[model samples]
Target: MIIPAIDLIGGKVVRLFQGDYAQKTEYSASPQDRFDLYVSEGARYLHLVDLDGARDPAARQLETIASLIKNTPVPVEIGGGIRSRKDVEDLLNIGADRVVIGSCAVKNPTEVKEWFRDYGASHIVLALDINIDPVSGKRFIAVKGWQENSGVTIEDLIADYREAGLRYVLCTDISKDGTLKGTNVALYTDLHREFPDISFIASGGIGSLDDVRNTAQSGAFGVVLGRALLEGKFTVKEALECWPNA
Candidate 1:
């Protein structure tokens, strides 16, 4: 499956580099316009990220998110500032197919595990944002859009989520996100090899159709496309051509 992103901030559809609002690219004034375009482009699964809302408190895009869920035809998997049971339940109630928890999961595994116990596996996804230490060969899960490092190891984090009974992983390499440099292909492949039983959703640095087909072979269930599609590096129809419809 192919997943398209609809990242929102301040009621507009925008994207930031490595999660920095200063580096944002204003695609559309309203997120609803982008949502409509993604649907018309043949997207079945919508990846919605509340960039500012997820990284900070006082970030409430629920009204906008709810509107998207209410108005759109496709199923949504939303993330960003999803912390408590109420948050997850509210989104699901508003028709979010899944809720992605990031910083909270790294900071509080016990709580995330509790969430899995109550909400079950399909309802929750562990969004792991990895930042590779260039010289040390260590990967730390970045929180707040790489502003703060959680210092959590990939092995330990993935293992903890797996132990908690969650089988889905949304892995993104922050450094490659929106750079159009190509994805961290080997990282996805390594994680896939390590956890063959889990389904991984590959994000960040999807530039060309070849990248899509190549990464799909790395055991990713789906891929998320952003700047490449938006900048006209390629079209959604071209990317969809790489996948056989179910």
Candidate 2:
């Protein structure tokens, strides 16, 4: 699947230079503009994240994002600041194809399961942001919109959520997101090979067309494009050239 990212912060759609909220660039005149740009690129699915929504679960840009979803031909999968069943319901009811559970999956594992039970695996996703501390031999999920660690390991998180009936998962390397540093392929490849049944998605550090090719070959069903796509590192059409059948 080919997906483009629409990361919203403070109600404005922006792209982080490297997950550095401060070094980001605003690319759209409006949310709808960004949506249209992606649609023009032949994208049929979008990865949406409300950066502000992640900081405060109450900071809802749902209506703004929902409005874009209605106008865009691509279906949307949203994350960032989803806390409750109501949050998930509101997004889905408003036109979100899938409601992503990020920090909440770590904060409330049982709730993640309940959501999957209620919405089914396809409509619910768990976004796991992995930050590896190599020297300490530790890995944790960066929570609160990648500002803090949730103290969860990638392996453990995937294992737990899969038991909760989660088949779709989005994984990002906080250190690499928006960096154009290339994707953390070894990690994703291992995870995908381990959980062969789940639809694993890689979501950061894709710099060039080869990155897109590597990601698809790594077994990630989809990869989200942001900086690279905007900077003309590769066209959505070019990325699709390397993507295997659907």
Candidate 3:
């Protein structure tokens, strides 16, 4: 599915350049307003991220999340500041279709695995944000809202979750995110080949319809349109038409 992303910072819709908080640009429209627009344009899924919650799981933007959920008709998968079972339950109770676990997945695999088992893989997503070392060309996972490195390799985490029966994964290359450059198609292709059983959704650095086409051709389960969609690089309708099965 061509998932639309609504990133929340201070209860307002915003997009950060390369995951830098200081480099963010705020959109005047409310989250509800954007969600309504996307829904009208044939959006089947929404990728909602709580920036505040990501900085500190204790500071989840529940009110904002609730408002978006109440206003939109489509299924919403939420991420950021989701650390415990209660956090997951609260979101699911409030109508979140799926809860994304990031930092905690790396910090406490055992707890997260239990959550995956209890909640079922279909209701959970493993948000793996990573950055590739320029010189070495090795990928390392990032945590704490992509501010800190977890020292864990992306491959290792994927392997860790494979045993837990993880069904969905949202992989974002921090360097490519919000840049409007293009997606890392080669990376996603390799991932699809490595984990043929998992559904991998590509995020970050998508600037055009061609990027979306490339992802669909790369065997990705879906693609998250962020800056490209917000900047009018392409419309949600066009995206849907390009990948009807997305």
Per-residue CA lDDT of candidate 2, range 129-206, in tens?
888898975668887667788778878888887777778888888878877989998877888888898888888899
Could you tell which candidate, 2 or 3, scores higher by lDDT? 3
Show the lowest summed lDDT stretch of 10 residues, model 2: 13-22
Instruction: Judge candidate 2 against the unseen true structure and give its global Cα lDDT, from 0 to 1.
Output: 0.82
Candidate 1, clashing residue pairs? 54-80, 54-81
Per-candidate count of clashing residue pairs (backbone under 3 Å)? 2, 0, 1
Clashes of 1: 2
Candidate 3 per-residue lDDT, tens place, 32-97, comes to 888999999989899999989878777889987987898888899998889899999989999999
Please list the residue runs of candidate 3 whose C-alpha ends up more than 4 Å from where it truly belongs after superposition.
none
Runs in model 2 lying further than 4 Å from the true structure: 136-138
